[model samples]
Target: MYGWIWRHLPGNAWLRALISLVLTLAVVYVLFQYVFPWAEPLLPFNDVTVNDQ
Candidate 1:
């Protein structure tokens, strides 16, 4: 899959690398800015339960 993407990207190796970095950063930014926040309330990570003995 990654090889497919690498092949699809335009330009030489250096430009491809730069484009990959920018694409990676864009994905991270979208996840943090929209996806994670939208999904946070549906996740159980912060829902802690402490049992008393």
Candidate 2:
């Protein structure tokens, strides 16, 4: 399946790179703005506190 996708996508390297970058950014935006915030409180690191004495 992966090989078929690679073969059929495009012959232009730049175009493929650009499309991959756009898709990555879109996924990151959705994760940060929606998914991450919703799941933040459940993360173990969320309870860490800083103490300056």
The candidate scoring highest on TM-score is 1
Clashes of 1: 0
Report the Cα lDDT for candidate 2.
0.80
Query: Which portions of model 2 miss their true places by more than 4 Å?
Result: 1-8, 48-53
Task: Tell how far residue 13 is off in model 1, in angstroms.
Answer: 0.3
Residue-wise C-alpha lDDT for candidate 2, range 1-53, written one tens digit per residue: 74565566675877877776776799999999999999988889857799999
- Give all candidate RMSDs, comma-separated: 0.8, 3.5
Query: In model 1, which regions exceed 4 Å deviation?
Result: none
**Backbone clash numbers for all candidates listed:** 0, 0
> How much is the lDDT of residue 30 in candidate 2?
100
lDDT score, candidate 1, position 41? 99
Error of 2 at 48 (Å): 4.4
